[model samples]
Target chain A: MEFTLIKPLFGGFLLGLAALSLLFFNGRVAGVSGILGGFLSFKKHDTLWRFAFLAGLVTGGVLLLGTFPETLNFTLKSSPPAVMLAGLLVGIGTRIGSGCTSGHGVCGIGRLSQRSMIAVVVFLSSGIAAAVSIDLIFGGEI
Target chain B: MGLLMIFLSGVLFALGLGISGMTQPEKIVSFLNVVGEWDPSLIFVMLGASMTYLTGYGFILKRSKPILAESFSLPTRRDIDPPLVFGSLLFGLGWGLVGFCPGPALVALVTGYDSVLIFVLAMGFGMYFFEGIDSRFQRGVDGGAA
Candidate 1:
């Protein structure tokens, strides 16, 4: 297999393993949005673990930058304004929707949750539509 | 021990995202733009992840309780509510607009790009904004019923 394909597959396996470990040991879903949201809420006795996980996430990113800089290499396609808007939408949407790619797309689908199946389909289709629209608006710049 | 496992899980998850190319906004946009130059790499990522998770999840569910926690804390809501649909739609638009979801966006912060920082801050604001509105709305409804 090509390196491109192998890399993603291996990375995906790691993601699955991470989710599994969280569930097996901590009995919590490794949903990034949920973890962050809960931390922000300051629920009693609930902040420490979330902080630890987020700190670990940032640490992992630091490690990747140090060891395999190539993996973290990429450029932003959208302008600053567009990027900011996108971030806002993602934040609100994930909060109201109760999940994101990791939570719904990975764990939810793995467990055969019907709601997650619908969510994945909705997000994927809408995402495609939005990308196409942005491409057209930007004359293929985005 | 539970916290340790969760922290390690976060680390592994971030590493996976970095290695899988999910940290790349352009790649995610290209993946979403199926009509354009499509990169099918994300499909493999999801496939590998879901399959691995599904297989392991089956075994994990068989256990009466998690090793570190008293019981599993999984989501139980099954209704296909309006929030699920509309929120996902909005999220997709944002994701398609910038190709950065919550996890990869956070993972990409190590790059120290100004854009990533801006995006994350805005996202936090958005989440906080929604929580405020949602709580007020809920309170209003409760007051009316009472």
Candidate 2:
């Protein structure tokens, strides 16, 4: 197969393996938002593992930068203000919603949870609508 | 050992995201932009990840408990509440706008881009703000019910 298909499928399989490892070994869901949220809460016993995981995330990025720089290539299409707003919404929304793409889109769907199913539908629809609207408003510039 | 495994899991997950083109905001924006020039590559990412996770999860669940922890600490909440729907909607809007969900945004922090830094800081503040509001809201509900 071509590089395009290979990259996603390979990467996705890696993600699955990561999730499986966490659950099988630690009994924790490999949800980024939840991990970050818990870390922020400052619960002493919980913070250590969360911090380790986050540190590992950064280390992984550094590894990618050194080994496969092309994988990390991309320019931000949105302006600074837009990006900040998006970040805020992501933060609050994930906190209140109890999961993000990793939690709801990947793990949640995998577990066949009805709530996750509903959440995936809602977020996908909202994301599609917002993306289409932004593209239209910016005349495809954004 | 448990912490080490979790850390390794994070590394692996980040690697998957980086290799999958998820670290690129533009790729995600293009994927979400179905009306415009769309990219369907992300669908494969989801499909591959979910199918693998589903099969693996089934096997894992058959075991009585995790190796490190006493028992599985999975979410037990099943209710379809307002917070779930509205929060997801807001999250999706943010995702579509910037193409950086929590994981990718956090993973991209290694780039040291000023934009990524700003987005992460704002996201942290937003999470803190939500916690404050949610706690107060919960208290209000309890008081009213009492």
Candidate 3:
């Protein structure tokens, strides 16, 4: 029960906070997909907003860690080669789709963007399938 | 100021990914394990994101006008369909293969990881490719926003 409650609660909290900050201070949704996507066709001045968004992402993580060192740890469960490939592919997919799970699935859907809503559903289902394939088909933990 | 705000937000997001160990592929893989020796740290990654979004969005919506862009860029669709399912599958497959996503990849970029660079490059290319089809679909959908 403890694990269940805290897990979703914190997930929701981080998302809610990020979303609000973008909406208020920046006048945007904290959709990583859209933000990152814009960088592809970006001009020099366009880099500013993207940079700011990325900076906030990193900063928020640091702030949380600094305040609650007790809640931090560094661990993982994938091979180096596999990890690299996976990273490469996701980077490609996110760019092509113009958003990731957070941007499309979380923010886009919340705002009810037709593209985002569809995108989220696709990515989330893709994610679940990815999980299944890694665990089942691969026969090795991904 | 508007542009600056976007930069700050990105950095904060990167920090979250780096500090929470989400940038580490091993950690993500372990969490996805769910069977033998399941490491639940991934929960923290999710928690970190949820927290930031919850508080960040909650406070921002109270403002009279948007602080960044000319106006809010709202999504303009309201239906669900098959392409949605197919796209998600592709995304998930890509995610499971690599522990990095757009957010975490950017975070890893801060560390100057060679892998992150490759991933980012390919990801950018992918977006360019997909936007074509996306636009095509949009046209079919009456350009109302597909």
What DockQ do the predictions score, one after another?
Answer: 0.59, 0.59, 0.34
Interface RMSD of 1: 4.3
In the range B4-95, model 1's lDDT, one tens digit per residue, is 77888889999998888888888888899877888888898998888899999989989999998789888887778888888889989999
Stretches of candidate 1 exceeding 4 Å from the true structure: A1-3, B139-146
List, residue by residue over A1-142, the lDDT tens digit for candidate 3. 0133454345444554556556676566666756655555464765567656766765654554565432233333556565555654564465445456566655654554667656755664565566656778777554
Each candidate: how many clashes?
0, 0, 87
Which residue pairs collide in model 2, if any? none
Docking class for candidate 1: medium
Alpha-carbon runs more than 4 Å astray in model 2 = A1-3, B139-146
lDDT of 2 by residue, B38-59 (tens): 7877888888788889989989
Local distance difference test, each candidate: 0.83, 0.83, 0.56
lDDT ranking, best first: 1, 2, 3
Q: Tell me the native contact fraction for each prediction.
A: 0.74, 0.74, 0.41
Candidate 2 C-alpha lDDT tens digits along A25-54 = 878788788888778868678788789888
